[model samples]
Target: MSHYYDEHDLSRFGDMGRNAPDLWDKFNDWYQATFQEGSLTGREKALIALGVAHALQCPYCIDAWSQECLEKGSNLDQMTEAVHIAAAIRGGAALVHGVQMRKRNAQLSM
Candidate 1:
């Protein structure tokens, strides 16, 4: 089954009515104005977006960013490297929290 959603649809899949279009539009406009020229080309930003999407664990965003990254000339190896970086960060985050869990367990006896 397929449902249609436009900017006005505002379904809460992820980025929905949480932000007003007026505000979102302004933010997006500013982003374009700030990063779409002079420095940090669209291709560079696409790779960054891909890395961020991986970190955020958003499948939809990941799909979009990966496509954009490829279109923007990021090779397969670069894309895979970005994903690996995200994986390492996520794993390190989980592993680092083990210290807190162990500490809490140790203190429970006291």
Candidate 2:
């Protein structure tokens, strides 16, 4: 019983497999270079990652980024605030879809 519902057989983040050394090397080169702390401080990066984790609905990333954010001196207040922002954005996004539903209902009701 795999926890993940992907064709890749691995029970994790889409199984960009490291078993293939050459592909792993290339992908790791890009991902590592891209997803690094970059210009942001560690705390800032963790906050952003937490928001993205929430938006993407990745529990593993949420857990990891929350820990990272805490370790990087993000207090509970800050972390929860970040989550609230995520919630607002996600909720707003869903609510915006009601426009489509409303338009469709109006048309179908005609």
Give one digit per residue, the lDDT tens place, for model 1 in 1-110. Answer: 26553433323443642568777777767866864745788887787778878999776678778888888888999998888888898899999999999999999976
Candidate 2 per-residue lDDT, tens place, 1-110, comes to 75554434424543556567788778878966765777987688789889889989877777778888988999988988888899999999999999999999999995
Which residue pairs show backbone clashes in model 1?
Answer: none
Best by TM-score: 2
lDDT for residue 59 in candidate 1, whole number 0-100 = 69
Query: TM-score for all predictions?
Result: 0.69, 0.73
Root-mean-square deviation per candidate: 4.9, 4.3
Residue 61's lDDT in candidate 1: 72
CA lDDT, candidate 2, residue 38: 70
